[model samples]
Target: MTQFHAYQNRNPASRERYPYLLDIQSDLLGELRTTVVVPLCPADLAENMRLSHLNPSLEIDGRRYVAMTQELAGIERKRLGKTVHDLGSYREQIIASIDFLMSGI
Candidate 1:
């Protein structure tokens, strides 16, 4: 049986096409969170998240789920258009969003 089958066998209708790789980051204080999501397999998902020094959340099918925080995960859901050449500036916006969400804005 395939690794995917172990997690997805219960639902044969599931497809790998829409699988998402999510990465989450937070300060040591756990007061800040940032996230990025890409399309990739579970192994690569863990690798990339590790490279970014963040923990990961795993899910199988739409019924079962794992997450650090919905709002933190929601950051990647809102795309920022084309990639920004200036990551410093872009990073500011991301940090601001995290702060806003955490502050209950």
Candidate 2:
């Protein structure tokens, strides 16, 4: 899977946990074992949590969602399904979001 690609959570039980997930795993890791993901949440929820919002907002199947930078994880590749959309155009913002979460600066 490509970095910055967003995928829908197919698991019904865990869908509420992270309705949408962004693939932040490094492409350099060719043949990935696990996909590093950052959860995308509704704009209001993101604002409530004070998490960084994915600039321009991400559109998945015509619906807009903002990335919750602070909520990140790595899940087995097998668990992820098809690509829902890609955030490549917002690369800088996405990277900055991660940096902010990591360094708080």
Candidate 3:
């Protein structure tokens, strides 16, 4: 597992709106039992209501998803399941969104 990699959202209750959880925790912290993640929501449902930079548009599984940075959380690594997609290409945006959430820049 690595930063910017997305995994299937294990909780079925929220899966329709957020189908994936993008791991943002650093590789150096891989040993931790809990992994930090941000839910990736359907663009049409989340984008318009989000702040700029705080919610980046991402492509996953041939669809567009909005990174719900404000929903950042840490869950058990085992709950993340297998990696469904690699979001490494959106590294800068992902980092920036987190930065914006922490520092407003």
- Candidate maximizing TM-score: 3
Q: How close is every model to the real structure, measured as TM-score? A: 0.24, 0.82, 0.95
Looking at model 1, the pairs that clash are none
lDDT digits (tens) for residues 1-105 of candidate 2: 889998877778867756878898889984868878887776655555554433325667766677777668888877887887888987888898888777776
Estimate, for each residue in 1-105, the C-alpha lDDT of model 1 and write its tens digit: 101111111122322422332233432423333334322234432443332212223334423222222223223322323221222323443344445546745
lDDT, candidate 2, at 79: 81
Worst 10 residues of 1 by lDDT: 1-10
Q: Model 3: per-residue lDDT, tens digit, 16-104?
A: 99889999999999999998999999998995678768999999878999999999998999988679899999999999999999999
Candidates' lDDT values, in order? 0.30, 0.75, 0.91
Task: Please give the clash total of every predicted structure, in order.
Answer: 0, 0, 0
TM-score of 1: 0.24
| Model 2 worst lDDT window (10 residues) | 47-56
Please identify which of the two predictions, 1 or 3, would achieve the higher lDDT against the true structure.
Answer: 3
lDDT of 2: 0.75
Which of the predicted structures, 2 or 3, would earn the higher lDDT when compared with the native?
3
Q: Order of all candidates by TM-score, from best down to worst?
A: 3, 2, 1
